[model samples]
Target: MQRRTRQQLRISLLIVAIAAGLGAVFGLAIAGAGDGDGETRAYARAALRGVWTGGLIAGLLTAWEYIYVNRPAGLWVRRLTFLGNVGVRSLIYLAAIMLSIWSGATVFSIEGADPFGWNAQTVIQVGFSVLFSIGVNFAMAINGLLGQAVFLNFLTGRYHRPVVENRVLLFADLVGSTAIAERIGDLGFHGFLNDVYRDLSAPVIELGGVIHKYVGDEMIVSWPDTAAGRSRALQCGIEFHALLAAAEARYKNTHGAAPALRIGIHAGPVVIGEMGDVRQEIVFLGDAMNTASRLVDMCRTLGRPLLVSEALRDAEPSEDGPALEPMGETGVRGKTRPVAVYAPAP
Candidate 1:
């Protein structure tokens, strides 16, 4: 929640800065149009001031939306159904829009000088401005910072040229998903999985992991080749299961049982490229990913909740968290040489 809060604030500020630049350009053009009052030049020079006058007001209103979205759900918050919550969400948007209009009017009074008088005309103009601002904020809320970056890059074929990156992959799957699904009907089981996945996002985000994809009951999280990512790789996996343990009560209460995570961590080079013809998407391709997936599967047989490859085990770790115990060699399917695995000390 904290990491997401930081991300949301950065994105909000970025969008507001862009909006201010645009407002300044328009203000300058309008100022240049006529032989203006001495104050026109003052306003022109301090365009950012006027823009910020609007931004600070708009930020306070919209920041709440980001908070609620990224918030950790309590038992009561989780219990609210879609219909039960839409009205609340609608009210938030409405309040945000109204506040933005008032701010826009305030911005028109730059440096204690007001050329535009408050009236229905002013209300209508400010209403339009705030509407656009709110719309942009809502879009950001929906797509998230990572999604927006990917979508923007896709337009320019940014990853068209395949590049190899040293990335650590964590393949975490729910243990006994089949049994869980059987206990809960398909529809109920679908909701259960959704809840579990949402829970997983907290630790991943907090630890700087990117959500690669969720394959049914399994979720794939990855990190770049940076030292921060490499060192915290295993710790993130450990903290993820810790998070599940912490949420066990909520899960049990909601579904009559709690699911646990079995994570497999591996590090290696992967070719990052764009894929798909009809609906394009970024793809991370490598045998390292396959090995990571296999390691997680091995967890079911080994009866360990967490497993790590020799590669990840040997890597210089940043945090003095859990110690990895040598688990001996195991024959990995599709590979000739047996791979060494380790389990985190309890």
Candidate 2:
């Protein structure tokens, strides 16, 4: 399966599992708090009901998100302002919560009590559901704000202390960005950059690369230094070009200019850790990053659209992949020794 599809499926399964687990815990608590009649039976029944209800609600919401609400470009509601979109989604979620509660009570209740009755039991259930939904939504919004990899690392404290690890870094810079910005006004150029970045995100996600940062018109993406990572980094470069080509018509039609990019890939060890006090963030420091940046700068001078260092090229030598043509040893700005660079044959 495509990586993007696989990612979505993984997230869906995780959501369901977590929701079901929380549901069971809440059920047990609710049962324990009730009057001491058939306590054992009540706990068992409540737990089962909670599992079923949680799973059902989670599954339904996941489907809605992946299929209609969060689908590619999504519905017209997605184009609405941020607050407007949030308002619409909140209404929909409230309705879903009410429906789920009513249906679950009807199916599981033995006394046949009025599901719409605003009793303490009903009030508590609705309150819990609303609070849980709010917490989940808030987490998701934070995840979107922080890139997936960064958020996960922060959650697990993976990079709390400095760690040395090998990683493949790909630097992609928009070619002739200054000219494009000049042609289009500043505001128009900002929109153009947004469009370009949006288009570039797909290939990176599909290749399982984490976007490290954006420097003006350049985007830096990283992957663990494994055979798979090396291969995907190279493939991502090719795919990046293809994507820009595919979007050429749209870009030209919309902004009167088609965008192009120059990419550079390199691999080596780097020190990674969370840094800063108020504006804290995970940062990578090493020659690998510097080398990768130098390679990208070399692209403009060497007139190559894509450049790969000898380290990366030698790491993943594939017979089926595009041939790498040697560009001869060249001295980069900061390095005293000349670096060996190669270009992917067209």
Candidate 3:
């Protein structure tokens, strides 16, 4: 299966699992509160019913999102104003929740229970489900606002305090960005950059790299400092190049020019920490980032699309990888020592 498909499936399963677990706990609590004669049996039945209902709701919602809302073809949906999007999703969720509750009641109803009853319990259940759906929508919005890695890190408190850790950093800058922006105006350039970034994101996600940030026309991608990380980073660069090439025609037809990237990679220890007050961000600080940026700048002089620092080249296992042609050591600004670099052999 393709990496993106696998990723989607994994996420869908995780969502269902979490939903099922939470539903089961809520079921048990509800059952305990009732004065039932067969309390144990009632609890067991409620938990089982909860699992089915929760899993069904989550599965259906996830499928809809992956199939429509999250795809590029969903531009109409995406272009909706914030309030418009929320209103639409709210109605959709309400419909889905009602359907889930009806289905669950039909399947799990006791002999005397009225599946279509309009009782206090039914009202409470629907109200709770609506609240839950709203909460889920809010969480999804937050996750979309913050990239996945940053959002997860924030939740886990992974970088609450500064810590030094080795990481492989890749800097990818758009080629001829200034000329492109001048040719197509600022607004057009902004749309073009969005398209380019959308195309670039797949390779990074598939190769297990986290996008640190986008600086103007440049994107910073990072991976853990390990043999596997180095290998993935190298592979990601190649894949990124291929992606841009594949989309060249589409880009030219849409925006009058196709974008290209000059990538530079390096590996070293960097301080990772959460910074800011009202608007917090996870920041990476170290020489590695600066060196990578400088290397990308050098790409213009060297006329290479991609450049790898000697450190990164040495760290990555080359047996099954592309051959690197040595580019003699070159001086990069802000560093006293000349950094040796290599380009992937043509």
- Which candidate number would show the highest lDDT if scored against the true structure? 3
The global C-alpha lDDT for each of the candidates, from Candidate 1 onward, is: 0.72, 0.81, 0.83
Q: Model 3 over residues 1-346: C-alpha lDDT tens digits? A: 8667798899999999998897788767766777764666777877877787788888888887887787777667666766676666777887877787677677776433435458866788878877877776666666666776677789899999899999999999999999999999999999999999888887787778988998899999999988889888888888889899999999999998899999999999999999999989989898998999998998999999999998777544346667888999999899999999998887
Candidate 2 residue-wise lDDT at 186: 85
Superior candidate under lDDT, 1 versus 2: 2
| Weakest 10 consecutive residues of candidate 3 by summed lDDT | 108-117
In the range 150-225, model 2's lDDT, one tens digit per residue, is: 8779999999999999999999999988988998988988889878887788788878889988789999899999
Error of 1 at 33 (Å): 3.7
> Candidate 1 lDDT, tens digit per residue, 1-346?
4655678778888867766676566556544543566565555654654465446545664566555555654334334554444444555656655555456545554443344447644465466655755565544433443452565566567788888989999999988889988998788889889888877777777777888877888888898866678656787788788888998999889987798988999888999888888977788898888889999989988989989998876554435676778899998888889889988877
After superposing candidate 2 on the true structure, give the runs of residues whose Cα lies further than 4 Å from its correct spot.
Answer: 36-44, 75-89, 112-116, 314-321
Distance from true position, residue 187, model 2, in Å? 0.4
Cand. 2 TM to true fold: 0.88
Of 1 and 3, which scores higher on TM-score? 3
